[model samples]
Target: MKYAALTGISPSVIAELKTGKARTLELSSAHNIITLTETAPGECLFITSVNEEDLAPGDAGIMVDLLVLNISMKRVEVTSSFAFEERERMSARIKVQFRGTTIARDVEGRKWGDPTKVEIIRAACYRAG
Candidate 1:
């Protein structure tokens, strides 16, 4: 699916946008907005939102890079004494969520603190196998 990025948007507003119930939006920030009127063949649309206010000066850019990296990586890993597992052959369209315990830098390409935890949420994928 093609990504349509929306930052500093509330979840409710996102839902409204997905349902085609919202024709307009009132943004409190000065960020730029891009609207898509149509998509080409074999293309799909998906909305992804991030809150710029919640991020540090350049952390938002890192988040965007992480997202691209996560999807392109196309694999999952979880390690623990009780469980250690990895998987490939998953859908190329799935999204992975990661949580960083701390950030080391206040600018672009910020480094994640030690002991960052990765949590993968189960969602619809292109293939279950």
Candidate 2:
């Protein structure tokens, strides 16, 4: 998702972008493995996987709520349950954050699940390149 100009990204987050590696975006509670994408102020955040069918639809992908503040730099809050993890995940709101290294195109994110399927949560930013 492409974000509008004026998005605020933390300087600490910017410094890590140079590594050319996408971070493992996980929730503070479960700390489950969701996405491995390079997050930035103007970039779109995708949830690659969360384990089991919880992140089902495989590479189908999902984006968080963008809102007025660009949270690509901090932990994102997720309150929806996935297809399989409805009660465990979606029951209560959870926080999400990106970490790890740059994710490659060959990863499951680009494949595995149906790319056509998508879930748009509270995110408001545009798709990242």
Candidate 3:
């Protein structure tokens, strides 16, 4: 599974050629993984293989969420052994804050019987400005 974080100056700000909300985000500091430079605008960074032995869980599954601040520093954190019942799916709550204003959305995924086939869920950007 591949995980990624996408960041870029909002198109409107970029068009104006101003740092109205421009900032550099470090993927390693946030996700503890190498940064992926892709063509996508909204996706700026990512971490993968959270299920690997090096970072595997013992009992309960994990919860992934992105903390996006007004300054454009987006952080991805994982909480292990999060609450979940058998046959229940996993979900991520993405929160975005800009200039002290906040908005949130949820990303949901299911646990496949086969671990190898587990799908990679994306915590997309709900607001770019």
Candidate 4:
């Protein structure tokens, strides 16, 4: 299994993401894996994920009910249940914070199953490059 502390993501929650094969995933609880800490007045350390399917559909990254911050730097760490290369494609949709304001984005991806499929999509942002 991949490291949760480092990746800021929970274990394979396919059961949580899938209700009955709907095109878009319904995230019941966006708390477990998503976390942020305010480092300064209008700055924070944010970490989240963007499933493989999200990239293909061009859907937004992790959903946030209230997101209003600028992403100075962003990095994605890909993890898979099996071979990561076997996946079709990878993508992430991040909102750029302007003037310290935020916008809401949907972080829904495609359906996934089996332990041998690429499942985990982790992302983190700390500082600018």
Q: Top TM-score: which candidate number?
A: 1
- Give the runs in model 3 whose Cα sits over 4 Å from its true position: 1-19, 29-39, 42-100, 109-129
Evaluated against the true structure, the overall lDDT of model 3 is: 0.28
TM-score of each: 0.27, 0.22, 0.20, 0.16
Model 4 lowest lDDT segment of ten: 1-10
Put down candidate 3 lDDT per residue, 1-129, tens digits, no spaces: 343322222344223323233333332222222122211334322223233233322212212233442223334454559754334222222332222211112111222221121223333447677
Clashing pairs in 4: 68-102
Clashing pairs in 1: none
Q: For candidate 4, give the lDDT of residue 128.
A: 80
Please provide, for model 1 over 1-129, each residue's C-alpha lDDT reduced to its tens digit, 9 standing for 90 to 100. 123223445556545444433133433232312222222223222223445335332222111111221112246787989999997532222122222112213322113221111112223336566
Q: What is the C-alpha lDDT profile of model 4 across 4-92, one tens digit per residue?
A: 11112233432332232212222222231132221122332222343333332232223222223222333455677864442232222
* Runs of candidate 4 exceeding 4 Å displacement: 1-8, 11-35, 39-47, 50-60, 66-129
TM-score, cand. 4 vs. native: 0.16
| lDDT, candidates in the order shown | 0.30, 0.30, 0.28, 0.26
Candidate 1 Cα lDDT to native: 0.30
The sequence of per-residue lDDT tens digits that candidate 2 reaches over residues 19-117 is: 444433223221221222223343444443333234332233333322112222343355655533322331112233332222212222334332222
